[model samples]
Target: MELELRHLKTIRTIAEAGSLTKAATALGLAQPALSAQLRRIERALGGALFERGRYGVRATALGELVLERARIVLPAVSELQREAARFARTRRDGLRLRLGGTHGPLLGALVDRLADAVPDTTVTTCTSWSERELAELLAEGRLDFALAGVCGSAAPPDAPQLVWEQIAVDPVFVMLPDGHPLARGREVDLTALADEEWACVPGDGCFGDCFTVACARAGFTPRRMYETDTASCVHLVQVGRAVGLCRATFPPTPGLTTRPLAGTPLVWRHLLGWHPAGQRAETAATVLAQARTAHAGAAARSDSYARWLARRAEPQTAVRRRAGLAS
Candidate 1:
């Protein structure tokens, strides 16, 4: 079919937003014009590209298949445009980049590395952010890199728009009051605590749908009676209002002990999230590179905190002290 970059963008926008009207507002096109644009493309393809329903315009099977390839088209075109400009200003332009992440320790080390390695670059980072808000800001040219947890691998597969480079794997644990019953257990499984009240972030937030998947794999959906996407929920758990699921690497707060679930997969992945390709805010790549390495080294910190977590899933006395926590 005779499709172009704009058509591909229209499809991705509709898919991510789950509605034509919202995509229109984001893309700054009138509703009629957007509708006609999609219709013409589907005509060329000899099939409907989007399914209209109560929720919004969702990609048809064909549209879903097309999106796999189309997702990269726009980004490749944007990068091509920028490469020419970059070639011209190879040695003269300075990089001004902004990076954001919720997994703080790893990224903070990355920024320090970037400062030492790339003196010409200036990067500022933030932890504890909303993915939707961060994605919006990054798309609108406000931010560059995002250090989020891993996203699912359910893409159409042909397009291959994302790359997940794992920096570290940390165990999932239950955050409980200082003296909760399960606090002293070396490890506890979800099935064992099927009846405990749970506290977690909303489904759209970081621990969203994935939490349900993790719990399902553990043999039960959590009895999540509370759903506040903040650290305050940890406080709720502390006061006996709810219990929480947390990765050892992304602790909600102090005095909340974490014990591993005997048979669950580790849900903590430190991921470096970025646009596949786009008109980035100048210094995005340099910052992203630093982040990837920072997570690697932070994971390798041979120190007490690292050993301490290892101790939790085993007898604490088995951990041998490793120095170098300072820096």
Candidate 2:
């Protein structure tokens, strides 16, 4: 009754469901109990939140105002609960390293190295979030470290609370169904698929923005037909519905294959972020070295990507050779 998250949830639920009976069913409470709870909450707030009518329940002016705030506060509170759970699990592990980030090949190696380096410390990994969120987790000490990608142009500013090291810069690849016309080769030009609909996560974050910039440089804006994560995006592509951008090191998906972009215009910068106060500063260098090795291993495992790297390195190798001859 003092207006906690439960009270906010109850108010929001009732507003969404449009009646106490439905809200009770959704919240697993009897209608009478739910009605009493609502009354108590209204008493605490000094205002009626709902107007009961023969047709259905509707939010009063006060209810609308309260619901607006609940919408913002509930998600944040839920995120806090999740982060706290992670922090608690880490504590129970006794000297643990918690790492969080987007799914990538480098995580396994990072875990292995951290485990070896710490000896007695348990290493835990969490993925499926954007780099910015991972960085925020590192800042909050919910995570000891994070290996995540950031837009090279709009990367976060340097902060006193966290240290970020640039680990890798890699091009994004186009994932297409095996039967798609463009899937016949190992490389696809960005402009060739200008007419095709894209399946992308609808966000202003790294992936979406990078795709937009890459398409702009290629002289066309991609048509988004589906908005979803990589897993669901793969399904859309598999059904020949849409195409998506993926990392070169992404594990092969059945019925689909990935091709490098012609100029590799879509690029992502991978960074290792850690809060200074969370871990021994000395471990940062070890983590960086491990991450570099992991990235290299990932690249090497992809034959087409390995060939591309070799082709890209040829000029640098020639320069080094010429420098040696001159010396």
Candidate 3:
């Protein structure tokens, strides 16, 4: 009978996703359920909102107008919620800083930074469902900061009114058993391992989706034998069960090694986001700096990764040296 914030969020999700199925996936709702909800919203609004098509869905004229209004209303409401959260209660030892991300190395670095900056305050990390969810937690004051790995330079998911900055661009690497044939090489070709069974995290989220897309581009679909987290994936690789995708920042694991994909230039860009309305901007800056420092430290600590960087730089250095000699 009446529209609510949930309805507004659904409208925005549909507009951005461009299809009922996709919007349902993003919102974690079944397709039929999302469609039913959309129908009700449309009925209440007195017109059709989206024009369904074979390829996808597009917003009708009425839908466009509603979305424009939703954008403005949602942020204001979120700001109000954020401000209200600040006044809930004053905690001793100042404010608690909640930091989180899936990157183990980055998380460790951030924890160290927080300890140094706010030794007496509470600091914690968590695994948020996704970047957008992490941003929501920040806006609601449930989370003070978040570190998420996003691929490419595409605009981040719509977490209205939060500040996001790219902290590090980590090169993607392939994890394999140390005794595997490809493990001896400095780098391995994706096509060379087309038939190899892969172990990757489940869900259409960042890690799995990126691995799938990359494999498909290489003219094969990775046979994911095990759907698990980084720890489990590493364990599987150690036993020679399957290979896994990895980032350079991950600490070295015994019986397992990582190599670059020879021709595929895959990467995960680390993003740090904070709630500006929560008045944690200064602290957020410190977190970002600490994360960058952590990334560098992680790379430095990994002998194989450090050597890879050095080998990559040698060609450039040699070219410069030759030029100097010529001059």
Candidate 4:
């Protein structure tokens, strides 16, 4: 029965709209519902907030006093929320960079770059295999940024409150034991390994479904697909129990060789996400640039990926040349 911020907001809306019907319309409430709510608010305050008139409505003396207080309190509370949001973005010691991500080489590289870029700021990271978990954390304000990947052209997490920016896109590759016959190939055909068991890290995205569709298009179903952690997936590949899927930029592992899938049946798009209303929005551009640089560094260090990039660009370059010749 006590006055609440929502009740205050209703009072203000009624005053601005100048009539109950108009206020109900503005607040998207049925007139009866709004009237009932106003009656409750008036009871809580022990007075009427408005006087009906031929023209519209006017505030009574007590209502005027309440209105004046609402005017002061609402704006002050709004400013308080804004200031608290700014303050909550940092830690007690100073500025802190909180990052959450799914297991990937890019997360480590991004951490390295962020540390170097902001030496005085404390950088912390949490890794979850679930992209949805990271998105939820970012929306809840627990993490300042989220680094995730989605299957080609698939939307990022379902969080509409967060803004997601593309950091890089890479063809998804397959990992094989060094002794495997396909290890020496520049690219392996999707159907070439149809009989091989597959292992992949579990994540919340359309990648699993996309993989199934890709395999179907390749004229075979993947055999015995296993969902496990990243390390376990690599171990499965190392022990030759299953082929592992990974980003093209996966660092070279001692017992395994990673190669792009021919025809690029699958692709990954790296994304950086954060709440746009958060203080981090101000520095999102800087963070995105650093993340891109880190991703480039990782891509550069992978010889196979570098060669793949070069080969992938040749078709575009040739098309441009053909167009120029035609002109």
Candidate 5:
């Protein structure tokens, strides 16, 4: 009953065509249907909107007033719709990247690489301690990519909507104060720290349980486990209140040292995840390559990891040499 935008559009069409029959054709409606609709529209406005004649149709005084307003309102509404469409397109194709991650150094490294590779891109980041939170954000289209880690051979978060790719795998390491007795060693046995308290940043995965299993395998139950943020964990280790468990790629701290577990009891895998159906999926491969490069750069910067790699390669190199000598 009330005047609506469609009624205004119909009025504008009739005025522009100068006849109901012609307007009906332009609007793809039959003449009778168009005439009926116009009657309803005019009745809703409480007056006749046109004066019909033998030659053609002309506007009455009321029709002229309605047509004048329709001219303004219809064009403005059309322009508004066009501008809205343009704004949507601009946002969709503007090379913006929304990245989410759990706490880690690799996210920052990945951001740095993206900045260098695509100078015009607008990059944003969201950080959380829980990998599930990041995965959910990606599924909800709030984030373009998610960077997180999982324990050795453990499944990534339970987001079937996302595709997870492994960027790198790292051996889990232990952090000790510079003055700790085990800090002098190249590697420390998990059992060697049986009586010491432990501190680790909390995550929404089974990693904590995995650590506990590793300790049990080493023949001792850790005395007291502290779940805290990364900074607090670092402080606990630095002040010798508790040993910290960290990835081998953890950056060096002034008062702390990181060493690999003697037998590599634990491992961490860096993952990059994205919704397979999202617009960002088109660039997923390129972004994944950049992430791998960033991870490699991080590993290269970790002295302990570099030494571990060298030592691991030594055994393989000696085996190759022995086989060649025998041959």
Candidate 6:
């Protein structure tokens, strides 16, 4: 009822540690001072939170309750503070976009489309990231949308928080040793090595999406139960460590093979990250729609891309085309 951020932090620390002295140390406060604050909070709430026991301080039912609420409230409060800061700066007139891709190809395509479609809108890419970093940033309103491969249905749901838009899909392949079974078959289908053990890109990397999206397009999901994201141990097609269901663009490691799936549509699943806060102005929406159109057009035939631009230009033209009279 009457607690501040520090008070809630202290309460959470105490509940998590289960001892006043330990919690104080954890919270970087003197034990006596921490104890006094806890006592004051208990007085405000008219209930006891911790109990003095043989082992140490332990949570009473109320302490546990307070801690639980603090966990949920504190994070939201912190995010709100950051979001609020943005409002004070220029009122966000233009769109600030954040785009992410699993690898270089998609990244290139994304830029090309935005340059063609929304040339007037400002576009920005993150400094350095893996897949998970992109996901976190998008979820936290740091990105307008992330242009990455759809590995699985692990993305956040759209509604109060986020909106997911599917842009396109592509096929999958297999990377294996040159002479490996199925590798020599000219195609890397899932059934070719259904029971194969594998090395993987961490859930935070491009290869991670490659595995999942490729598996999904094959009508099956990959079983990547092992992880290794290291410098010298790049995720290339190696002789002993593997045969994975993915495309050739993956880290191109040595001693491995890359082959296409025979008849499977193992593909590149693309998505647009939509944040309500990031889409505040008419300019943002127009830019977003433009970027979406350009990417779609670029991925297809050039004639189609140009026609798509004409179609986009029609919206503005039609209004002008009809402004004088019903022509």
Quick one: best lDDT, which candidate?
4
**What tens-digit string does per-residue lDDT give for candidate 4 at 1-327?**
988999999999999999989999999999999999999998988988899998888899989999899999997887567556646664356678788988888989998998888788788999998899999887766788889989999988987568999999999999999999999999999999999999998887999999999999999988898999888999999999999999989998899999999999899999999877775555788889999999999999898899999998999999999999999
Q: What C-alpha lDDT, on a 0 to 100 scale, does residue 305 get in candidate 6?
A: 27
Model 5 pairs whose backbones collide: none
- TM-score of each candidate structure, all chains considered together: 0.55, 0.65, 0.71, 0.73, 0.71, 0.61
Model 3 C-alpha lDDT per residue in residues 1-327, reported as the tens digit of each score: 799999999999999998889999999999999999999999999999999999899889999999999999998997777678764523334767778675357787778866886687677778854677776677677877788767655565567677888887767788888899998998899988898888765432455666677778889987655877778888888988888877776787889888888764577788888767665456667778887877888888876678778988999999999999999
What local lDDT does model 1 show for residue 282? 42
Candidate 2 clashing pairs? Answer: none
Report per-prediction Cα RMSD to one decimal: 9.8, 7.1, 8.3, 9.5, 15.2, 9.5
Error of 6 at 229 (Å): 6.6
Model 1 lDDT on a 0 to 1 scale? 0.64
lDDT, residue 48, model 2: 98
Report the lDDT tens digits of candidate 1 across residue range 177-209: 877887777667677777788876543344556
Native-structure RMSD, model 2 = 7.1
TM-score of 2: 0.65
Residue range 303-325, candidate 5, lDDT tens digits: 99999999999999999999999
Q: lDDT of candidate 3?
A: 0.79
Error of 3 at 274 (Å): 0.8
Each model's lDDT comes to 0.64, 0.78, 0.79, 0.89, 0.88, 0.60
Model 4 regions more than 4 Å off? 1-87, 90-93, 280-282, 317-327
Off by over 4 Å in 3: 1-78, 87-95, 202-209
Per-residue lDDT of 1-327 in model 6, one digit per residue for the tens?
577888888888887787888888998889999888888999997899889997888788987888789989999997786466544322756545556555434465567666766666676776333555666676676666665545534453333556566655544455566667675554555655656666544444344555565566666665544555432223433644555554333434456555566654445555655555545566456545654664554445333223334655889987997886875
Model 1 CA lDDT for position 58: 76
Evaluate model 3: give its TM-score: 0.71
- Cα lDDT tens digits, model 2, 1-327, are 567888999999999999889999999999999999999999999999999999779999999999999999997886677557655654574576777767666898677766766778777888855666776677666788888776655665344467888888887778899898888876899999999988764433666766777788889988765777767888998998888777777666689888898977877777888876556556567778878878877777776677667778999999999999999
For model 6, name the residue pairs that clash: 170-267, 170-268, 171-266, 171-267, 172-266, 176-257, 236-253, 237-256
